[model samples]
Target: MRLTIDHRTTYRFTAPQGRVVQLLRMTPRNTHDQTVAAWDINIDCDARLREHRDGFGNITTMLYAEGPLSGIEISVSGEVVTSSSSGVLHGTFEPLPAALFLRSTPATHAEPALAAFAQAATVGRAPIAALHALNAAVHERFTLVDGRPEAGLTVTAAFARETATARDLAQMFVAAARAAGFPARYVTGYCDALPNGRPTPHGWADAWVEGLGWVGFDPTLGRSPEAHHVRVAVALDAAGCSPVAGSRLGEGREWLDVEVQVSGQD
Candidate 1:
């Protein structure tokens, strides 16, 4: 399948800021299962973007703009060709050892409850099967809410609510998979949505299979991803894979809006 993505993020503020800086992880890299045919990024305001690759191998863009500006927009458009790899990631350069992902971040910390849940979910299974079981268990246990969850909610917190956005669920899956002794990471990207409906950006978890390398699982969908998924950025936690993250020079209440549309062609 060939997929196209149009993602735009806009920021509006109550007062003008002196400057704004952002890190963009919106570009998709070519993998064995995915090929990037075209990609571009545009900013509505005056800014200089410097591109670099991060440790996790994600393509990062640094955006800097001097502003007495009230708003800014970042737009990303791209096309990719993807094929099913049975969830295994191959042919991409991975700079960090898989064990590095075993180290926990605050968002994915494995508390006793999470550890116990992981143990219960994967009892008597092989590593690959265990990951599949954990993925399905997470889907069965939690519901996908329509909107994003409140910011900064941890894996345990999402479990308490019994529902969360894809981002939170992916984070939970990362935490649980790590507790189960599998190195895991968070992936942010695009996926096909229902026909004629606007597609939103997606998030999922990837676990290192002893013989299979990294395999992706989407707890939100209760299955491993296939050709419909276009992977963009990956990291130990969601924040690191976020499409855009930034800070402003001036202090004022800011409102954010994001729009994403993903379509596919045979």
Candidate 2:
């Protein structure tokens, strides 16, 4: 299957700033069961981007822009080829030891509700079945509310409290898989939506199996990702894996708007 993705982030503020810099993790690396037939990155604004592999072996981009300017915008577009492999992952570099994934992050800490979900996913050793079951359980247990989370509230706490946004569910998926003794990570990406301009909030979780490599599971959608999913960046938590993470030097306040569109081009 061939997939195409378009992501645009725009920022408009009341006042201009002096200098701005950001870290971008928008590039998708190759792993077994997936291929990057074509990949491209572009910045409409005046900025310089440098590529570097992080400590976890995940690709990272350092973008720097300096100006006595105001608002800025950043966008990304790409395509990929994919196929099924029993949800097995293979052929990807691992920087940190597999044990590192078992540890909890700010987003996926200890919680009773999340622990129970993870136990359900581990009923069988089959990677496909475990991940599939996890996805189904997540979808049924929580509702996809339309509001963001309060500051300092991790998905683990949110699960116990029975409240979450798309990102919160994503964190829950990762935490549950890790609790099941799998090297699971959090994924940030885009999901294609209906043509009627319906809202499509994209987020998911990835698990590392010995034979396979890094397989993705979208608990919110109740399934392993197929051709329509476009992966951007992954990390131990949702905050670290954000497509754009940076700060701007300004005086007044800042406003941000993000738009993502994905399509099955094939």
In candidate 1, list every pair of residues with a backbone clash. Answer: none
Candidate 2 residue 188 Cα shift, in angstroms, is 1.8
Error of 2 at 113 (Å): 3.7
TM-score of 1: 0.97
TM-score of each: 0.97, 0.86
Best by lDDT: 1
Residue ranges of candidate 1 with Cα displaced over 4 Å: 194-198
Model 1, position 200, has a per-residue lDDT of 68
True lDDT of residue 29, candidate 2: 82
Q: Score residue 111 of candidate 1 by CA lDDT.
A: 86
- Cα lDDT tens digits, model 2, 152-265, are 668757787565677777788888888888888877776663224344437788887766667777776777776666666767888878777877888878877777667676
Model 1 lDDT per residue over 109-161, tens place: 98899889999999899999999999999888876776655788888777778
Reference-based TM-score, model 2: 0.86
**Quality of model 2 by C-alpha lDDT:** 0.73
